[model samples]
Target: MDKNIKVGMADYKVASGEEVLITLGLGSCVGVIIYDSSKKIAGMAHIMLPSSLEIKNNSNKMKFADTCIDLMMDELLKLKVSKTSLKAKIAGGAQMFSVSLNTESLNIGKRNVIAVKEKLKSLNIPIIAEDVLGNHGRTIKFDCNNQQLNIKSIGKGEHII
Candidate 1:
């Protein structure tokens, strides 16, 4: 049986083998899934913002793409998963509201996606798949056993990456 782990908004979770990780209601937020097929280790992060530097809160590292990915990498390393073997699948980062059309700060989804990609590149983690940048929200499920990322949206239905 697969153990389902729920990753909340601005949070992250790690799993191995047949475990499944899920996150929901991603609008301007992004869901990042990392997996090592050989080790059967997987992690999912729900990032609400692009950078931690922009905010002074200093709380909730998972709320920022840069810090969130770093935290997840540390956990994966602790679990004995090789960094070189890690691959990523990202979803969400949608432009949910029309008011965010041209505004930089309000267009958080685009910023989140850019920051995520930059962070992943810096960490040498290749993003193998992604479903991003639209006008709707998303919910995602990451299967550790097969490294399959299942993405679902209200009007978009479902897609596997």
Candidate 2:
């Protein structure tokens, strides 16, 4: 039987075989999914910021897009998953605040999505699916056995990608 492993905000988890990785409350944060189909390994990161470099003395590396991706890749490689076989799926990155004046800092959701995409591109990891950009929170479920990402939102029902 598959078990659900919860990944908290500003956190991540890696699982293989029958385990499923999940994360909740991804508002203005992104849930990044990296999976190796043949190895049946999956990883999920719920990132809160675009760059770790922008923040001084950052304690949690999992909270930033750049660092989170890097850390997740390290974990996946530790599991003996090939870098070339890695594929990505992204969710969340919502505009949770009503910004009267658009600013770079205020557009955190958009910034996170862009940063994640850029990081994946830099690593040569292809993004297979994405569910992003809106004014709502999200709960993500990643099934390692099937390599499917399911996204849930209030009033939006659920979607699989």
Candidate 3:
């Protein structure tokens, strides 16, 4: 039987075999899924911020994209998963509210997405697919067995990436 592992906001989880990683309520937050398909190993991070460097109270490493991905990579490496074989699939980072200001600082969703991509590139993990930058929140689940990311959004329905 497959176990459903929940990755909460500002948190991360790693799994292998038949385990599935899931995260919910990703509004202005990004759900990053990194996996080694050959080993059936996967990690999911629900990142609330782009970088931990910009925040003073940055104790939680999983709260930021840069730190979270690094930590997840370390975990995967310990599991005998090679960095070269890792691939990523991301969802969420939605612009949930309308903002009159055109300032980039207010667009946390876009910033989160950008930070995630940058971190993944720095690690040489190519992103296989992504569903990001929209006005709807998302709930995501990553299946380790088949290496599929299932994304669900309100009124937007659900789809696999």
Q: Is candidate 1 or candidate 3 better by lDDT?
A: 3
TM-score of 2: 0.96
Off by over 4 Å in 1: none
Candidate 2: C-alpha lDDT: 0.92
Order the candidates by lDDT, highest first: 3, 1, 2
State which candidate has the highest lDDT. Answer: 3
TM-score ranking, best first: 3, 2, 1
Compose the digit string of candidate 1's lDDT tens values, residues 1-161: 64999999999999998899999999999999988999999999999999999999968888999899999999989999988888999998998888825568789999999999999999989999999999899999999999999999999899899
lDDT (C-alpha) at residue 110 in model 3: 97
Local lDDT at 158 for model 2: 92
Among all windows of 10 consecutive residues in model 3, the one with the lowest summed lDDT is 1-10
Candidate 2, superposed: residue stretches over 4 Å from native = none
The lDDT per prediction is: 0.93, 0.92, 0.94
User: Which scores greater on TM-score, model 2 or model 3?
Assistant: 3
For 67-149, candidate 2 gives per-residue lDDT tens digits of 98899889899999988999999998899989999577789999999999999999999999999999999998999999989
Error of 3 at 91 (Å): 0.4
